[model samples]
Target: MTAHRFRSLLGGLALACAAALPAAAQNFPDRPIRLIVPFGPGGGTDLIARIVAERAGAALGQQMVVENRPGGGATVGIVALVQSRPDGYTLAVCPPICATAQSLYNPPPFNAERDLAPVTSPAELPLVLVVPRSLNVTDARGLLAAARVRQGGLSFASPGAGSSGHLAAEVFHRASGTQMVHVPYRSGAAALTDIVAGRVDFYFDTVASALAQIRAGEVVALGVTGTARVPQLPDVPTMGEAGVQGFDFPSPRLRVVAPAGTPAAILARLNAAFTTALADPALQARIQDAGGKAAGGTAEETRAELNEEAGRFGRLIREIGITAE
Candidate 1:
């Protein structure tokens, strides 16, 4: 064939492929989908991912497999998600860790905003300020007073250097004008154990993780991190309400994201499936029981929330000088 004829043929083929893209998306998830949870099994993110996937898979007519890839402050798995093909098969469950990864890492492997496309947020949970029953604090003001007197003598525990709990504590110190020694741990359970043993003075832990302890009277919940009190702990006042102004730490939002450049049609389908799953009455109750509320909305809403959280936490991380160890 002549050179001109060959060029024309290539153009025709490109148009044909472009035309078929939407049809391909329409037949999406012909196979199982992999949902990566960037934390170890049994953690809040992993548990929430499993619950949502079990129901979303039914909506999508395919199996949604939960894959744990825990490392690098939850960025290892997110980096993997970023590198995956944007065909809508590989997705990830992103929590507050994702929002802070870029801020905490010296040079993050992937930018959550640039590399991942938000699908939807499945749930959100507030962190609660909990202290050992042995401590004498009962509210935010009392905790701040205690910290002020002790200065760096009092210590706060977190799952790790950049986890939500860690940043929340940092923000609390910044807003309350009190300083406390930061104690980083390998896991939330470990941190909670120390707090229960009175090894640590306080910890900002998720309601889910600290609920049992709070109910058992092992730890005292000083305040919740949300703008409003959490239903699970209705009597617990918000940090702002408890006397700490501008003390709202962004709640941990569980978002679903895919590799950037995924076809818009495919993203829409995935969003619909997940949102429908979140709307199920059984799923909402289960989420509430787990100390969170179901949150399902458009991809744009998720994107906005993630961006807002990243900006808010990034400023706090910089102000606190928190670096990944």
Candidate 2:
């Protein structure tokens, strides 16, 4: 072929590739996409994961299959998704647990900062400090004094290491200036159970996970782990508002992260689909009705929040002298 003809063909090929990007993105979900939930069914993580997966799947014209892989403090599911091909077929629907585990664990194969690209963090489910109704401590100040008086006598639990429970307790130690025995469990629901039974002195758990017990008065909400009082629980102040300047640990947030290196077009499409799906009034209502919050935003927004929290969690853990189990 003539040189001019060859150049024309190359230009046409580039144009074709560029033009096909949107359609290529739309062509995704040719098969069922796996929305891996790193927790057992019936927990808050499962509830939100299924809700978002179903709604987000509908928006994409593909079935979002939720697979529950509850182990290794939720690292099992997150690592699996990270290692999978980044064709946008495998996605992780997890919470802050993944980030916490990544930081607290002794050695993590998957680098959250590098391997898992943020898609979005739909909403934050702030963890609440709950004690048995019978516990003497009723607020952050009281809890701190109680910890001091107990003299390393109290015990606390998290679903596992690197979970909100573990990290929140770590922060409390800094504010209160004491350490509590750390108990590890496979699930937050399990830890909440022992707290209600008085087998454990206290637990910092997601509001959704501790809702039932808190309502039944089996546990009392001392304060939330945010900067302000949760609107839903107006009676409870945030850890900072409650006078613990260094004790702000939000609950396990539901985050959507795709494997790194997915096409930018595909990532944009997926991000749009997620934001649109979560913003729907009906979907938001459904989440609230189920006792959860729906948070949706741009990929960059989620990344910023995660980055901030990782630094905060890292510093708090080091100050408290807690190590990954």
Clashes of 1: 0
Question: In model 1, how large is the Cα lDDT of residue 297?
Answer: 91
- Tens-digit per-residue lDDT, 45-145, candidate 2: 78877888888888888888989987776778888898899988888986765555555666765777888878887666777888877776788787777
Q: What is the TM-score of each candidate against the true structure?
A: 0.95, 0.88
Off by over 4 Å in 1: none
Query: Clash totals for all models, in order?
Result: 0, 1
Highest-scoring model, TM-score: 1
